[model samples]
Target chain A: MDEEAAKKLIVETLQKKKGKSKFYLKDFYKMLPDEKPRTVKNLVNKMVGEETLEYWSSGSTTLIGLKGVGKQAGAEDEED
Target chain B: MVEFRHKTPLIDQLETGPWTSFVSDIKREHESRMENPKGIDFQFNQDCCDDLLGVLELSYEHGRTHWKHGGIVGVFGYGGGVIGRYCDQPEMFPGVAHFHTMRVNQPMGHFYSTKYLEQIMDLWERRGSGLTNMHGATGDIIFLGTSTPQLEEVFYELTHNIKQDLGGSGSNLRTPSDCMGQSMCEFACYDTQEICYQLTMEYQDELHRPAFPYKFKFKFDGCPNCCVASIARSDISFIGTWRDDIRIDQEAVKAYVGGELKPNAGAHAGRDWGPFDIQKEVIGLCPTQCMSWDGSKLEINTPECTRCMHCINVMPRALRIGLDTGCSLLLGAKSPILDGAQMATLVVPFIKVEPPYDEIKETVIEPIWDWWMEEGKNRERLGELIKRQGMQKVLEVTGFKAIPQMIQEPRSNPYVFWKEDEVPGGFKRDINEFRKYHQR
Candidate 1:
């Protein structure tokens, strides 16, 4: 799929999900045909930097969400 | 051929026996093992035994041979590794064994009970070295080494039916309080044990999970005596404080002055002479020289008083503390990590919250994780991170309002000032003068 088409599919999938925090580049890539994992990771990092999305977890199963999705996770919350 | 260094007479004098020989052998082996042989030196430390066990366990686990010596030895691995130290006198420690170490539970402090302690002791006595340090530094109990197969069984039994947990090790919440509180102490203002147990129960998952870049410690003291030294050590320290007037007894003071009562010895001995005599004594002890006495009235120069509370505790009956009080939340205090020694600072003025209050948990824990998760680098302690980043950032992220008690960088600021004219001196007769007046 083309870049524009992939972006559209990603946005649609994010909107459909009950938890926006669950959306990730991999999810977007999985929905699109012929998308590289690296591309997905880069796009996600870019979004996080732009404050459009939040990224947590250093591992492959990273938790992503809108900048302010649920109540602010406290200092204690970050323990998990 | 390896050249064997004969054991010294000092080594023989020390009844550690083969352990010292083992260390010598390791040193000799290492000399040959490495192309460049470094001289073997023996240094002793009380805490080294546990570290030595950890090293030995990791070495054996990795299929590496460890040379026994009189001292502790261990290697560092990326995530987890063993440390081992040898003690000279095993008979002094009958229930322990050689080649023992602890398994690091990444974030939280987890451990089994006294029974587990006994079992581990039994295993150590049986298969490995006859010595162990139960839940010492890393908050995990040190199991003296056993056969590789015994390790699995031991780990399983210890982990099974675990009661108390291994507290935080790497960048996570540490084990909660393990101290007596108001239930035992006359000075305790809150139920510290309850709070500690509550937190432990409520946040078990958080305690065990290793998500943060560094580890965190929470410690609670029932009162200012701070048996745990929570203020200086823990990332989140909860100390009990009263906001009420101190209870003073004039009769008790008079009796104390008559040498009827004496304070306990050691650091606090000189200051004891309660209910009222202690306050009278404070006239001389006040650092700011704010306390004064007339023939009939005792006055406190509030502005000059540093609120150290020495007078109040010294004469509990003669002087009562105020009831309209709250705890002063301090921050940024920690042990030396990236920097030198640091002190826990008064960050929040008296927070007017009820005791047994979960607000402490809500307020302190939330902000701690937020900042640590965002700003902390691996192995950097919470206090170090806060110091590097600044308290403003912590306040912003934690959403805690700043107060006068939150005196940032107190050492840099001048002491609280009082005008010289305000102090009343020499108005009242001294104890000797009073005697003379009575005689007259």
Candidate 2:
């Protein structure tokens, strides 16, 4: 799939999946099975760069979330 | 501004001894801060030192620690570099209730100038408990205690004024450290500081954010001497080494025999260990039994030599490490927590350590991370994961060959686990054939 279609699909998936804002980069790869993993990774990182999505990290693991959706820095999350 | 005058009769007893007390240091900081007081803004009304002392006294009284792990607290846009801590009895000691630790990434070899150190101390004094760990085991400049609110401010000051970044904490890529290789030591095979700095800069994102299942550390040692103790401490250890024969000076060896030069570069100068015996001390002590001395000179069996540095250490002037130098990449070393302490198992026998370190990153580091991230459980260390899965898995993932250097000796146990592919008929062999032969 193209970048635009993949991006739309990811947003839709994230939107539909209620009560869960954060996801692993692997989750995105699973979401777009048709696209190459490298392509999907690049596009996801591109979204992060554009602030369409932000990274939620627990120091041991990193998860991707829609911008302004999950806990930002210093947001009182429990230890992983 | 209020003076912290909490009575601590139990804690005070420790001050009478000759050894300098930590309580005294804290008290001094408290006194200094009180004299030049700033408006305390956090919910904890008293200064950090006051509350910290209060909590310690309470702990002494109850014989139990009151401190508990706090929620995730860190600088903006970063996941790690800050460890959150809280006191259970917040009402009794408000200052230390939200006490946190900020780990600042120290220089490569911890070669800090006075000005840089002063800048860090100044920032910590203004914002923290003034308790500093000169360097943590991971080699970060640890800012011991501060409030949750002050974390960002301290980070701002660190970045803006000191121009330094936070080190890794939690499960991220920890601050890479190295021995004083070319800076101080002559036995250094590679530039440890340069490689450490390069990897630190190259993997900045990995350091600041959580990217793996658990914490990963990179420690560089200049040579087999392992001054940094990376073999048992770090997740990935780069130990410098050489492939060529040891360089020997026959004249210098003769000088030591004549008592013209001191053995071990005068390291044992204070001790009267009698005259130096070249045969008994140097050649006799060689682990590989590779060295032999005739009447005229010493000869070494280079192929049999394991490069343990025993001979060279004893006679520094007479011998030197070979010129063809590189490093051995060992993996999965950690302190005993679950499966017990593990010295890093040799993964790469030798790799030329150079700028960018692309060979190591591409061939070893990235592959292992990719595998571990997929297979590793949460809170599990890399060594633990490697232990759970056999070393063969590691070799398969990294495309490393099975070399004799990977193991100390051949396995004594006869119960070998052979793969189905390795068997002649594979695992699907008919059970009827076995019954026919056995006549069950």
Candidate 3:
């Protein structure tokens, strides 16, 4: 899929899940089933780099969400 | 270089114990660093050891800790392997104000050459606090304290000079570790170290990146003895076993019985537990009642043997693991966190563990990761998720058949969750039909 189309679909999916601001990368993989898993991952990572999406981590796990959405990363992150 | 700044009366009290104190270690490091220093960039102009002592003193004084968790701090292109930390009393302890931890992945079996060890120590001395935990709970060489800005520089030198990579820290595959199997142990059923290295190399991206919904861990054990405690501490535990009969040396067994050979490799030499009695100890202790002695020879009912390794542990000279060896793949084990602690549930009972363990990856690992990334909660461990979703779902997802070995015992409650499709008539059965039959 083209970058624009992938971004559009990803944004649309995140926007549609009104109650849930955060989602696993696989959630997007499910939304774009026709694309290869690796391809979807690359697109998502690209979006993250572009500030279209952000990562929210619990220190044990990380979830992807639309920029400035859902839980914020803070002092509660997992310690060594 | 900095001088001793804090007068720690409370910290001093701990040094009076029988065991060596960490306070002493820190004081020694403080003195040593003050005398001869290895420079780090962005110098706080305050000694880390001194500040560490100060923090401890403050913690003891306040009756609580003065450190707070800091936000994400990592090397370029990686989401894990570094944990950020900060002191609440930064003004009083500037050196540890931005202290962070870096977990360097250890070599297989944690076997390090003297040259490699020195290089790591030298590098750490230059770039961070010389103090280190030989290993952390997750089996990584933990570089305990460093400033945030120096992270990338330390990582670069570590990878370039020492030829070492960083271990996992955040919600990713924590460092894959195993006991020293074939390398140092005779009881090893399979090469645990080889598999650990292979898996670690294979899943480098997963190890260094934050991909999972929660933390995932993989631990390998050469035998069911589980020296590394994989069964209790990992998300996926690969434990070696065999389906064939336990190899027995009748002569050795006789030697043990005749008091010519020692039991438990003579490990209990300090205590006098009376003469070894095979009948009272070995045979009597077999969980399955599968062993017997017939005056001249010892016999084992191999078919009924559960491979619990009790008899083998007791009579190591006589008993050996079966020749046809493989490992059992168990899933979803972790410490007490969101869910209570759980030992890994048996999933695949036996698999021939070979190099580039593609069978394990395809059959178990990938499928579970795929499912977990989709269904697992934000901080839910795989074990907790498995418990919440039920083992039946795991069986279906992994394409494994349900076997009796998967569970400890059949459910005693008889509260079967009969699904609609499984029953002859669907769950939509009419109350009117029941009323017609009973005339209620």
Candidate 4:
């Protein structure tokens, strides 16, 4: 159950947030309410290693985005 | 005098123009309403409005009535009454962003016990601006100033002692309001006070929480005269009306013509609504062109007569609203934000509005919102959601699947986008197809 929930949240969050801009591991880590930073870090590492999520490094920060999930992701009605 | 922690120089600069006259007039109006202007405090509230003035000036830069941000503030498990505002020019005007407002839901018809009103006034004087917007566009008593920390405690005590709660805000059901119904108006067909009170109480939790995609408002008026103007303003509007034909008293009509009717017999009388004055005033002015008069009698064509209150208002002795009183429901009205401003659509032409109003909740109110909450976007209201996914789909989801109003001439109106699945099994294509079938 935890694994399924964690996977769903990661996919939905990546889909909702826009742009190629980098998201810091610490600030991004804070958004998960129930799961710990360690659990999320391990999940993120596993997913990145498996090529299910896009991950890279810019300076000391880590960034992640969707892996061809455009069809599944709904576009948010954001103001310009 | 209360010292200021926040001040905007731009507000002082702008006060010299049209604002000066506006402020002076409002101040005079405020003083007139106050019993003891100096007893508790009036100066603090004035300063609060002055602070908000700076924030409002910044809001107008984008477009009128559009806010660039949301910083809504309130007490625990409650997000209704208080509104927080911020000035856009942070560098130019520092510490000017924390301008806050408190809104008290207006009593139905603005009726209040003198003791209750005094209790509220004293409370406001002590904690908030003695000044207020008598009623705002949302039909709430808007108290103009207070900081964040002071609001929670003030609301807790005030709501408790006053036996009232704060009104709704954010993406929940906002405060529902109504004009004086049976309490004052002779034309009232349904109980405005009861409906307003019941809905407010039933949805109290919804009113406090920001759970919906956007805000919802409900307002009521007794008749088509629309004293509250609910048709253009509220998201859900219940207008008092009748399904049966209007009642007319012919003997009384003759009495009015013969100069034998009394002036206080409800409404019309003589030259000052006198006996001889009604034929032209009442019969001549009916918009539906359904009334006629001879020397001895008055005739009302029931089928042609629209249930407008003109004749009834002019000669209450001669005409009455029908016995089968009910209400009409309209949906989707709001000021423009993400979309253009919209007038409410006549969703339910007539529904019997008896006590409990369970039918209204079951058929119209709950279903429409259930669909909206599931499908609605961040700023999209029910009306706009209809535009995105078709009205056919909205009606289907809301359980009004086969309304006669939706089945009528579809080509005539652009908003009536019918689904192909809704077509009857043995349907004919058009008039030509119908004619061919008849010829057989």
Candidate 5:
């Protein structure tokens, strides 16, 4: 899938899974099946850097949520 | 041949005990092997084990790997073909520690004379690991356990002695290998050895550079026999082929039919078993159903023959491969690592493989290097990159339009895909047309 489409899919999925507990980085990567792990990691990092997505860490695991969408998701799930 | 080792920190540790069981086991096995009629000489690589220990000491940190990890490294001058390895754990059993490997490119068909073999073996024994892998997956002679200094010396001497340098490393070509082509095989259509040599010589710099995103291998097979296993191993594969007819020797065929097939299996073997039923066997077993037996004689519809090695292997004396031979180029086959394992896809259905092989190199090889260098990701093999960035882009950039024969295997996965934006030109109204369009 194209980059724009992939990002769109990620946002939509995050919105859908809002308050459904957590959306871990690995789970988000799984959603982008065509993407390489490196590519997915880069995409995630870019999104988090730009605040396009909110990253918070639940213990050691990292989670990504859409920018404006609010969810307890989990504490310390990649959120600095 | 020579002993050129100095005891380091790791060596001292291994010899100071705790490896009593392992050492005794090795001695026991060696003793048993010595009992065999053809005796065995096992070189207990004490230095290699020590090196292993040293690596473990360096790499192991608390519960994980240390800072110095995988990257491009060698003795010096040489760019690739040497793989540096580290021990998984120093805290466990320290004896079996430093585990680095070096890859040596072999000549076509691996035909090494005793003298040359002895020379290279001497280098390995004195400078690095006495142990060697005859042919690894990349077709290079993997020399296990060598320090940075030792590796440099080996490379220097090897190039000076044989004039043949190390195979590719770090994103470049991984040695082009071929079977015993015209050298000793009657089945060989094109000169497999010649092409292998030509490619190695022409692209020496490329072979020694870390230019591409990852490793690219080129393996050649003399015929569909695929002795070199190009079909499933290489990024670029060349298989010798023909577009003509199979030659039949009726006299040889009749001799086999009249029970003279295996004249020397034993003194009375041929007379007792009688003749093979050619009609029931050879004719019936022709995969494409293209052969006919007219009671006494055998006739083969050559065009329908898939060159599957069945007929030639069965009746070696009677059937001869055609003269009008060339090669077919296949792309993107490799062992799984980042992406899943893949079989090569046919790129060029057929091309003339005459001297210099300009057409094949220019039309097929160069374009691929150019394209992959520009787009492929680091550590992404050619096959994986092609899958990631659509085969359609490869077709467009390489200018190799797809053909029916180019389907290396029936599509079993969704990895091979075409982009909606890049459509093929020329469409007519028919089912065959649809098939043709999809084939591209």
Candidate 6:
């Protein structure tokens, strides 16, 4: 898949998850079988740079979530 | 009854302007004695005359309060206390001007037994100024105003009891200081007391001898809580740190959040809890920024943490440090030694050598001596040397490999590699996972 198709898939996946805070970039790669790890990383960086996603890491696992998705997903709703 | 005579010319010259007002008050008090029949012992001793000349000579060049050039004069007080002064007028303080300077013998932690303290105090009363500065700026006890003739005799008596010479001053390895380590503090990752003692014992020859390009100071702290502020102060700083992840106590953390106990509040309170859930609270509370969680189990970010024991201090039951962990060596962190004061640079990434720190001695200490001996200028510190030599030369001499973690950010260096296999150890998945993939 090309960059455009990859971007389309990410946007669709994000829309499908709706108010979900986190999603695996690897799952997006699985959807785009021919795309490389570098391509997926670059796309994720672009999305995060655009402030659409927030990326945090633990050990060797990167957790990518929507920037304000936590607000929408009610993760911090109890505290607020 | 004895008559007292004041040297009118000297007093007039010395007591000019505002000083004359104070002199008038003193004259009024001594007026009755001045009229008495017999002559008081007002003759100056030859030694005092010589000291007076020396004081006059120094004062002529540098105004009295110039401590760098002015010599210290101490007067003995009645109750074993000595009044010390870096004076412009040594003649004014007569008894103290005649007293010899005494050097206080300080241990690694500046610790002394009750007997030792009393013995030193007694010696101060007998041979030198009856006062003691627990430790001077160079970290030695300074008993000011001793005669050159009495110096040897005083030293002989002091050492005969303590069996150690006065510590180095004026271009030598000054006394080493260590923070209260295992004896008192909880944050000590390494035995600071032992390291101080070990360095003192191991370098006793160097400590007493003025051999270095300039004075060198070594200070140790058990952890980055830095009770001694060694990193910013010493020529060489040994700060206790660990390579392992900080241990966490989820249960105690739960209790703290549930209000079962108050968190440690005073000096050692590690980190601030900023309104996060108890289970996820560990991440924010660690000094190293090492603690983290993924809605399951808590994890520690070892590389980022300085092992300040903040998390451990906070959740004592949950967080405990690992064993046999050595310290990280930070170089050139002198507080304005040369260039504007700089925090010590992390020199040796991290090494695992403990109390009998022979490996550290060989790797860290020996290299420092060789570097300073060969290249350092007068009064220049190790950090200044590194600043002069540049980090590349320092790494070249010390044999430390350049890594991404070496500099906070990637600089234009051909040696640093970003590829997986190019890294010293094969880059693990965790390295990739935490890449801050969101960088702009």
Best by the DockQ measure: 3
Question: Each predicted complex: what DockQ?
Answer: 0.03, 0.20, 0.26, 0.04, 0.02, 0.01
lDDT of 5 at B312: 73
Over the stretch A5-58, how does candidate 1's per-residue lDDT look in tens digits? 655566666667783454433354466546544455445545555565554322
Give me the displacement of residue B367 in model 1, in angstroms.
Answer: 2.2
**Candidate number of the best TM-score:** 3
What docking grade does candidate 5 earn?
Answer: incorrect
| Shift of residue B353 alpha carbon in model 2, Å | 1.0
Chain A TM-score, each candidate:
0.60, 0.84, 0.83, 0.64, 0.71, 0.65
lDDT of 3 by residue, A1-80 (tens): 67798799889888888788777666777888887655676677678777788655434555678876654433332243
TM-score of chain B of each: 0.62, 0.90, 0.93, 0.78, 0.76, 0.69
Q: Candidate 4 regions off by >4 Å?
A: A1-80, B1-22, B25-69, B87-97, B255-280, B401-411, B414-440
Which model scores highest in lDDT?
A: 3
Task: List runs of model 5 lying over 4 Å from the truth.
Answer: A1-80, B1-72, B88-99, B162-164, B263-275, B389-391, B407-440
lDDT by residue (tens digit), candidate 1, B96-205 = 23433434332222324677566554444443433444445534454444332343444444456433233333333556654476565566666666667777677664
User: Candidate 3 versus the native: TM-score?
Assistant: 0.87
Query: What order do you get sorting by DockQ, best first?
Result: 3, 2, 4, 1, 5, 6
Which ranges of candidate 3 are over 4 A from the true structure? A5-42, A47-80, B1-3, B37-46, B413-440
TM-score order, best first, reads 3, 2, 4, 5, 6, 1
What are the per-residue Cα lDDT tens digits for candidate 6 across A5-80? Answer: 7777877777678555565444555556676543564576566656665543221123456566553321221123
Global Cα lDDT for candidate 2: 0.80
Model 3's DockQ score: 0.26
In the range A15-65, model 2's lDDT, one tens digit per residue, is 888788887666776798876544665677678767687665443445677
Write the candidate numbers in order of decreasing lDDT.
Answer: 3, 2, 5, 4, 6, 1
CAPRI-wise, candidate 3 is acceptable
Tens-digit lDDT string for candidate 5 (B294-323) = 767778877788877777777788888888
